[model samples]
Target chain A: MRRPGPLALTCCDPLAAVTNATARIILICSGKGGVGKTTLTANLGIALAQLGQRTVVLDADFGLRNLDLLLGLENRIIYTAQELLAGSCRLEQALVKHKQQPNLALMPAGNPRMLEWLTPEDMRTVANLVAERADYVLIDCPAGVEQGFKNAAAACHEAIVITTPEMSAVRDADRVIGLLNSQGIQPIQLVLNRVRPRMVANQEMMSVADVTDLLALPLLGLVVEDEQVIVSTNRGEPLTLNGNGSPAARAYHNVARRLRGEQVPLHDPTRERRGLRARLLNKLGMAGN
Target chain B: MALFEFLQRLLGRQKPSGTLAKERLQLVLAHDRSDLNPELLEQMRREILEVVQKYVEIDLEEGDVSLETEDRVTALVANLPIKRARPAALTAPSD
Candidate 1:
């Protein structure tokens, strides 16, 4: 539930000062499928909420919506974006607040049938309504540059393009960046996901430099490949929810902090790979080795 | 086998597959960004040759046009072999 307060009065808290301004509407997208777009969205949503900023994650991928499932709010959803837009329910009625994180809310977009009738204007209308109450509105965009993508991008002022280091993913991301540019979206950023450090060190997989040099976008963060991500996803809990100290979880937290105008340094893969052995030795009190 | 592999590495006789992947991605992205396929590039070469031949004689078979990408910027590079300049009378207007 949303609490009412003065819209213009500035607060002593810096986080509140940011929330006083209009919500930042950002779209998370990737032109290719199964490249961790949804995963990034769910994790980032939780990370932002943990930072004490009121956040709303809208699942704009109507054809194959899963943000709710990833957030473990599927069973709690009684009304969706469809009902809100149809005037059967209010925005508060459609929004499902997280059980663990009350600061975060999830708005599941209408089902696949709504794909036939929903337009870009309708998306904007819903986004506008959601923005009135949130400090940040993250739209989980669908894959590919189709109508769904357009509807998702239509309401966003900024974009975060997520991609793996593979050739196909990078090529598709480049295309999606071109589309976002044409739409006049500003300050687009990139996230490199599922990076295997050892493979990169052995020159078997694409290095961070290789992908960044070609994409030509400021990298927001790097998420190392971790098996715990699969385990967390199957349990319908995002990596950022629990303080597991997983590489991907830390990366998500760093990304959220950076988004709030903090200066967190990016992760280096080679150093992280070497640090594992050193950390193990330190834990065993064998630092001299 | 390990010694032989070490020797090959020391002598720089082996190429890493990452280098190959980077090279291939550069070539393909150049084409993809410029929206120019091999057939289109050939057409462009022929048109460029026709325009250049109006002022100078060029070898039609030896002319080539291709895309090159560096620092994320793509350029259309052409190499046209010149046989000789056209005669003044042919190049100049009749008036």
Candidate 2:
């Protein structure tokens, strides 16, 4: 009998290569630290799950893993990715199920000292295993363009760069994008995080258009600065879960929908506050007349 | 404080923090992308001036060399005024 063709290969194909034609691997990377890469990864995983996509988040930052904490699954992590890879535990045993969302799960990072044992190829192997059981695999990459970044990005087919409006963040993002291009990662998207509309309106900050122009990549979405983010983080609940209709939560949902090929109008909802104020002023003027 | 800020804004002497950040980032990023630091650029300028001085007497008082950027491309541009032509022996055409 003739051997099965490449086209016949599926996620169920046990012989499929790591990062093969199985699932969409998205690496959330940022060159600068404290730019909300982990937060975006956690909330985005939930948002994707909410959209009916089975999502698995892999905290690739071995030394300083925070995805588990972001998802409020830190205390629940029984087995880490290191244990799974070492064959000490099965892949399912390593997955920490989301308490509220059945479709979402997380594979926490290994020990920092054990980071030396994991390579880019190893990351791809682990990602392939997790991707086999999920529709999407979002890897929370470590900050900077170091070994950790290489390991995180190795198994991914696409990348999403998160940056703030600060020139420092954008410059680092440009360098990161250049590095990603050199790595042969295609279809990289930009997430303008922590955008302040008041600053942008006053020409004090870079607008979405300015950022997109400099980076020259398709924008994934813009996440406005919201206080609810801190609240959700403090409670270990993702902002996408109990965001109570905050702009950041909606933006995350829209980003997930856009990932599923939905056309979302690119509008900054934070800017709507100004429009409302103008309408209120007009009403007050009419009433005065 | 408010009056001072108002005067600063009125005189156009106070640049918005955002604009300042953007301009500063642009300059730093251009230097970073080119992998050319200010010290290395200065050294290169000195060497270029030395080479040009051999061909003609340069107006060192006004000559300048700078790294200029257009769009995303960076170039080392040297602008030197000729004070006098060199001797025929120095600038003679090769056979």
Highest DockQ model number: 1
Give the number of the best model, judged by TM-score: 1
All candidates: DockQ: 0.30, 0.25
Candidate 2 lDDT over residue span B3-40, tens digit each: 57534644566755555676676667667767887999
lDDT assessment of candidate 1: 0.82
TM-score of 1: 0.84
DockQ of 2: 0.25
Each prediction's fraction of true contacts recovered: 0.42, 0.42
Candidate 1 lDDT at A152 equals 92
Candidate 1 lDDT, tens digit per residue, A116-228?
99888888877766786799999999999999999999989899999998889988998898789889998899999998876665454678888888888899989989899
